[model samples]
Target chain A: MTPSHTAESARRSAGDPPPAELRSRLLGALEGLLAHRAFDAVSVIDIIRAAGVSKASFYFYFASKQAVLAELVRQAVRRGHEAADPWVSPDAAGPSDPVEGLRQGVTDGARLWRENAGVLKAIVESWGSDDGLRALWLDQMNSFTDAAVTRIEADPEALRHLGGVDVQATAAGLTWLGERLYYLAAAGVPPFDDQTVLIDTLTNAWTATLYGRRAADGRPAGGAIVDGHEGR
Target chain B: MTPSHTAESARRSAGDPPPAELRSRLLGALEGLLAHRAFDAVSVIDIIRAAGVSKASFYFYFASKQAVLAELVRQAVRRGHEAADPWVSPDAAGPSDPVEGLRQGVTDGARLWRENAGVLKAIVESWGSDDGLRALWLDQMNSFTDAAVTRIEADPEALRHLGGVDVQATAAGLTWLGERLYYLAAAGVPPFDDQTVLIDTLTNAWTATLYGRRAADGRPAGGAIVDGHEGR
Candidate 1:
């Protein structure tokens, strides 16, 4: 398995299988269950039955359904981090172009939302009432915020356009912006439900925020070469 | 009371008071309780006790706790509509600047969130699991998106800067962007929790989305006469 897929394996307990084993099965089962029913409606028996595991095996891994939720969130966040790697990488600053990096990252991020919409929706819904989930959610978002801040600060071109804007707050707000848009799209809310529109709108928002306005051709005015074409 | 304040009164049952009455009191009580506890933690008995009303009175006004939540969401949305009036007003197109209108509207929006954070948070958190709330929430959000679309389409100066951007999708994404940031600020999530930062970031994002890039003075380039100062 790729390193990103095995990243969750490090969290496994001493007795768990060496690879992503029963614990992953349990987590995957919960994710599958969320596709059709509300988290509150899904019980331990349902989860184990879906995974073809016993009640004892379920409890042996997750203390509760919420525990599985927390792990699913962690796993989702890891994948999110990997997807955004292009934006945060040093290579994004040079010939690679940060705006293009943003386009790639956002497209991948949208796909991530599409793939794990149910797990993400359930966890987000519960974060308000669950302290552990709330804290973990914020922490995961901050990682994205931090990555954005790093990218923005490192780019003089972007900074020149940002002017006196508060980088930290801007980054965090944009991070929350993406989270909310993705959530709305995943929930099949109108306007945002169209995946192509979601991706384009986000790319334009980020570009306009970082540069100034987009050119008539829909590229940021004077920042980067997009898909091998220079800005007008 | 102003027309905005009495907007919810029209929804009162025939038996309720002529003006803002016991139903409003129940909503106010629930809003108050949410400040200290999660919606799931606040029971009907707790709501009645907090409102100084009887169980019969509570059930007479609201079918269930979830019903109360739906009403609270409706009331909050009405107030939100009032808060965003400046952005959608025809005056926003002429002598009054749209960007400044945006500033005033965003400032009012952030304050609305601060005042109704707990209530709004509870409803938003529950929307995923509750079909009634999910529909109500979407309908409410669409109202804001409509306002944004109206404003964007009405302003030729703003359009000149927009180029080929999808007005409907762009406006919807920006609307969701503001909602998410305001929620984070109200929830006391970092960076966004700083009220000043939250308002500024939102204002900037809106300006950027509508006009391309903000100038060094933080006004949208070549668009509006912001606060009596023309863009350089």
Candidate 2:
């Protein structure tokens, strides 16, 4: 098994899995509620009511509303990391075109963000004020950066050109950039229009930074290059 | 005068300037207060008390506590725009080395953000929840982006290579990226350490994006290229 898979298995083994059905219901309820309102405005009672779970059951697995949101963020971060498989997975064969591989990774990452935009938005917006959320979000960012550093270290050619760049810091800065940009887009901020613009513009920045060039070829670098199904 | 200057002058003309002494007192009070606490946690009463001004006097010049914060944001934005003179001012003459010019701009911008880090942080963290603050912040970002776009458009060589890049969108994205990065740095978030790392990493990204290359020369890009005294 790959190191990443083993790591995942080890993580899973370390913790008692939440009663899957109740946890799923709570998460789904939070997601549904977040789709319409800001997270700060949502209350624990609201989550319990939406989940159709008793208060006692709500406390059975989680400690607070923040804990539930933290769990949701943890899931989103895992999904986001997994979606970045095109670039981060060491065992996965490198794309025939390196730049295109970077673009595909960015595109997939954007798609995942868009899909979970609500929960992701909550995490981004609330983290500044909520210590628990902030720690979870920071952990996620570091994990993504760690994955990026690993990918860069594994690829000799990419590593050569990144001589002066601080690999860890660059990865961290870029990761935060993607998060903030996608958050702004999801929150309906200006200049961050539809998904296509968000995806393309971000892919441009990522490709430029990592590959040292623009995605000039008009080829659609979204789906064809990366095996989108592997992570699932 | 340019359109932006005309707009600024017009804005100045629209309102009777606040009594210099009272305004200074209030601003100083707010700055002192913000140094210790989050903007949201601070109240209007706190400002008036700190300023040693009557409630009526506070209302005479400012509409709310938010108005005070908005004014601070406006001043910070104007200072930041001025600090970007090295890169954005068209008739100011481009630097001898283009990449160095870009680096200097990034460095100046970072310094301004660092100087007013507290107010800037308050604006960033609080704006997400407040519509008025959000609009003010968005206006600041767009103005910065407009300046960047203008700079890029004025330079024929940079413009040419930016063919695939939607110049305005690219500028806007980079501008937001800079804002978020600086915000993270100013907020003391992890991986964004001392001023050197912040300035260097950001300079690298800005130089790469605008020039389509890194700042390869080892020359000091901070003070020599641009008249640091121009904006002050």
Which candidate has the highest TM-score of all? Answer: 1
- What do the candidate models score in CA lDDT, each in turn? 0.76, 0.73
Q: Candidate 2 at A33: error in angstroms?
A: 1.6
Candidate 1 matches the true fold with a TM-score of 0.81
After best superposition, candidate 2 residue B220: deviation in angstroms? 14
Residue A51 of model 1 has an lDDT of 80
- Model 1: per-residue Cα lDDT over A1-232, one tens digit each: 3454343443445865666487888888899999988787899999987886778878888888888999998988898887778668767453365666677777788988888888888877788777888888888888888888888888888888887777777777778778888887887776678766677678778888888755223332333324544343
Cα lDDT tens digits for candidate 2, A1-232? 2233321232244345444556777788888899998887898889888877778888987888888889888888788776776577755775777677776787777778778878888888777777788788888888888887888888786676666566777788788788878887888876675566576677777667766677753345553433111110
Q: Please give the distance, in angstroms, between residue A124's alpha carbon in candidate 1 and its true position after superposition.
A: 2.2
Off by over 4 Å in 2: A1-26, A48-64, A217-232, B1-26, B52-64, B91-94, B217-232
Q: Please identify model 1 stretches exceeding 4 Å from their true place.
A: A1-22, A52-57, A92-97, A215-232, B1-25, B52-57, B92-95, B215-232
- Please give fnat for model 2: 0.34
Report how far off residue B102 is in candidate 2 (Å). 1.0
Q: What DockQ does each listed candidate score?
A: 0.38, 0.22
